[model samples]
Target: TGLTPWLAWVRGQAPPRRDFNPCGAYRFVRHPVYLSFMGLVWFTPTMTLDQAVLTGVWTVYLFVGSWLKDRRLEHFIGEPYREYERRVPGYPLMLVGPLATKRT
Candidate 1:
């Protein structure tokens, strides 16, 4: 809804193309959008096997998709995305601490 306009604005202002997928979960999860959405949904008090499975599926997809996108962005956007990733939490959880810290 409101995001469409904001996304358009961002796209307009984004740097010149350096080749990107523009399809991965990076913008939502690596960026603030999906992280905020997850926070809002986390406390919902409903649970069902089907809903749980669907959530799991989407979560897995987001993780895998983000990994691939990171590889591309690391080559394109370079160090900035890597640095931002370290500072900001991933969508579902804050992957912090020594174990989670990315190694070059």
Candidate 2:
């Protein structure tokens, strides 16, 4: 449901949406892509020393980048984003219940 709107927004054809997203995987966590990337980094069956180092660096970058992105969104969207922040966890570890629960 959201992919098209997101793609449109990314293309600069639309403004940042004022609506809150609490559906699908977004209901479980705010940053699913970052979580997926982290999972890929840590859950690999085999990793060389260099891969481990790279994973660590990427993990750090993800955390920092997500923080920066969140701040930017909050600044751009203001109260709506702040309310969403209160309702949704930014990290997967912070998830509290089933992924489909739409808690507004």
Candidate 3:
């Protein structure tokens, strides 16, 4: 986030707090905003060859961005983020796959 609390992490100091539970779409996926952007990039009705190439590049960029974000949050937010990762998928389709939450 590059905010003051995030800056504290860079300085090797504790953040003001570690509470960062996002609501709404976050409940379904760890990176809902990334998923939304991907939808915009991929769901065009007509895809020309150039558009297809652009979409492919953008897809990789978004996927890498989402993964880097997870690593950053894990580094900064620590255990809670790991727990959240366990409970939430990185993307909605993962809800039914290997990283899906285990029932208890």
Q: Rank the candidates by lDDT, best first.
A: 3, 2, 1
What TM-score would you give candidate 2 relative to the actual structure?
Answer: 0.70
Worst 10 residues of 1 by lDDT: 14-23
| Pairs with backbone N, CA or C atoms under 3 Å apart (clashes), candidate 3 | none
RMSD of each: 8.4, 6.8, 3.6
Ranking by TM-score: 3, 2, 1
Model 1, runs deviating above 4 Å: 1-29, 40-42, 86-99
**Cα lDDT of model 1 by residue, 1-104, tens digit:** 35665776788864344443333565434545544544444545896888777777766665666667667767777777677566444553546532133545
Q: Candidate 3, TM-score vs. the true structure? A: 0.76
List lDDT for all candidates, in order. 0.56, 0.76, 0.80
lDDT for predicted candidate 1 compared with the true structure: 0.56
Per-residue lDDT of 7-101 in model 3, one digit per residue for the tens?
Answer: 89889998677497879989878887888889998999999999999999998888788778888888988888888888888887665543344
| Cα lDDT, model 3, residue 62 | 82
The top-ranked prediction according to TM-score is 3
Off by over 4 Å in 3: 1-15, 95-104
